[model samples]
Target: MIFMEDVQQSQATIAMPIDRVGVKGLRLPIVVRDRESGVQHTVAQVSMSVDLPAEFKGTHMSRFVEALEHWEGTLDYHSFLTLLDDIVDRLQARSAHLRFVFPYFLRRRSPVSKAGGMMDYTCRVDGYLKDGKLTFTLGADVPVMTVCPCSKAISDEGAHSQRAEVRILTRFEGFLWLEDLIEIGERAGSCQVYSLLKREDEKYVTETAFAHPTFVEDVVREAAKGLDEHPKVTWYKVEVESFESIHNHSAFAVIESDG
Candidate 1:
C-alpha cells in the first residue's frame, strides 16, 4: 500500500527558520544511575527540541520519541551528551536541547531514632548541544528546617521555626554526586529536615534548629559559599525560600554566579 503525501517534509512557503520546535511533558519511565541506589527507576518529564530550518515545513515530531526509545543504558551526563548528538544528527538540526524533570528519592536515617525513610527532592537535568559542544546543568530543591534568628533571640522560652526549601543550580566539569549537593543544602540550613522523627528525634531536631538559627539570606549565602569551594562547579545559583511559621507570607533570598 502506498502512503499519503508527505506534508511535514514538504517545502514551506514562508521560508522562515524556527529556533526551537519539538515535544514537552513527555513522561517516561527511565533508569538513572544513583550513587547510593546504584540504579534508580523513576518517571521523568522530558522536553526535547531542535532547530527547524526554513527549507522544511515542519520536523518529524515522532523522531524525538524514537530517540528516547533507541537510547539504551543508564541515563547520565555522558549518556545525555550522546543522546543529544543522536538527536541533532537524526533531526538534521544545528542545535538540540533536552531536559528531564523528576522527583528523586533518597533514603535518610533519623538523627536520634535512626529510623529509615525515603525523602523526595525536586530535581532537573538539562543539556544543550551546538557546534560540536555540549553544556549541562544540574539542579535540586532541598527541604530543611529553618529557625528564625530574631525569634530565637527575642523569645524567652521557645523560638519560631519553619520548613525552608534551598534550591541550587550548577554547571560542573568533572563528577559531582547528587548526595554532595543535597548535603550542602542540608548543612546550610538551620538543620536538616527528616521524614521520620520519633520523640527523641523530634527533640533533637527542635533543639538543633533552635540553636542553629538562620535567615533566608543566610541560607543562600551559606550555600553559595559551599558551592564556591567546590572545584568542579564552574557556575552556580542558590536560592532559599522559607515558609514562615507565624506569618502568612514567605521569605526568600538568592545568590548567583556566572563563573
Candidate 2:
C-alpha cells in the first residue's frame, strides 16, 4: 500500500491562530446524577472545541469524538472537568471548551388533587479549561404563572394572568445541583406551573397567583434573593420574562451579582 499524505498536519500559510475549532450540534447519550433518583438518562446536544495553534494547519476534528467516547461514568462537575482536560491533552492544545444542552425531567404533583406527571426543563452546562484551570456554569429555564399587579389593582372583576419563564445561570464554589436553581426560579413567580392539574388544583393556582400578583421585576428580585442566601453560589445571573396577557409586547427584568 502507498503512504497517504497527512494534509491536516501540514503547516498553515496564514499566521493567525484559531481560538476554537471542533464539532458542534452533535447528539449523544448522557447520564446525569439525579436529585431524587440515582441517575437519569438523557440525550444532549454536545459541542466540543479546542484552540488551534498558528503553526498547525488544522486540528484533528475526529479526536473530539474519540475523547468523548473514551469518557465513562456519570456526568457531573468533576467528570465534566476530566472531559475538558482530556480534550486539551488529546488535541495538544492550551485551552478547551465543552457545552451540553438537554431537557431535564422532574416529576410534579398537583397542589390539591395530587395528580402526578413529568415536567421538562431546558438546561445547559458549559465547561471551559484554560492554563490548567477549569470553570463551569449551570443554567436552567423554568416556566411558571404570574398575575399582573397593575391589572389586579385596577380591575374590578378579575385580574389578568399569564405564563412567565425565569432563567438562571450560576457558578458555584462547591457541589450544586440543577434542582436548587430550579426551585429558586419556581418560587420567584406568583405560582409554579404543573403538568397535570385537576379542577381544584387549577382553582388553587389561579387564586394563589391573583392574591400574590407580581411584575417581572419582582420575579427577578426574588430569584436573586434566593441565590444570595445560598452558600455555594459565588456568582449568579437571574432573568425573568413575562408573556403579557393584555399587551402586545412582553415584559422582562434581569439581575446579576457583582461576583
Candidate 3:
C-alpha cells in the first residue's frame, strides 16, 4: 500500500467562515434584579450571536454556552454588560449580540379593597456591541383596561370597555427598569387590569375606566410623552392595541422617534 496517511493529510481543506453563529431560544432559569424589589426568579429565552471574520473558519460554539453558564442566575444591567464584553472577547469578533425575553411579576394592590396580588408582565432585553460601542434596549408588554372615549361620549348609558396591550421599546444608556414601562402603560390606559379582583374592585375599576376613557391615539401619545421624559432613554417606540368590545377587530396605533 502507498502512504495512505500522507494522501489523507494532503486532501484536507479548511472550512469557510460563518457570518453569524450562536445559540437561540435557550431556556434558562435566572434570577434578575428588580428595581422595586431585590430579586426575582424568571425563565429567560436567550439568543446569542457573533460575526465571524473572513479569515476564521468557524467560531467555537461551545464557548458561547460556557459564557452563559457562568452568569446564568445573576443578571442585572452591569452583569449584562459584562456578559457581552466577555462574549466579544472570547469569540474574538468585531460584533456580538444577545437577546433575552422573560416574564416578570409585580405585586399590585386593588384600588378599592387594597388586596395585593402578583401580576405577570412580559419583558425583553437586548444588548449588542459593534466596533467597540455597545447599545442596550429594554422592553415590556403591559395589559390594561381601555374604554373608548368616542364610545363614552356618543353612547347614552354604558360605554364599551376592552382589554388593551401596550408595548414599549426603548434604547437606554443607563439602567432602565421594566417596571417603569409597565407603570407608564398602565397609567396611560383607562384603568389598570388585574388578575384577581373582588366585587368592590370590579365596580371600582368600571367606574375608574368610565371616568378616564382614552382612544388608541391617546394611549400611544401619552406613553410617548412618558418615554420622552425618561433621561436614560435615547430612542423609543410606543404601540397600543385595543380589543374592541363592540367590534370584532382591534384598534391599533404606533408612535416612534421618526414619527
**Best candidate per TM-score, number?**
2
**lDDT scores of the candidates, listed in order:** 0.90, 0.92, 0.85
Q: Encode model 3's per-residue lDDT on 70-119: one tens digit a residue.
A: 87467777788888888988877788999999999999899888889999
Stretches of candidate 2 off by over 4 Å are none
Tens digit of lDDT per residue, candidate 1, span 65-118? 899988874578889998899899889899999999888899999998899999
CA lDDT for candidate 1: 0.90
Give the Å shift of residue 164 in candidate 1.
Answer: 1.1
Ranking by TM-score: 2, 1, 3
Clashing pairs in 3: none
Worst 10 residues of 3 by lDDT: 4-13
> Which candidate wins on lDDT?
2
Colliding pairs, model 1: none
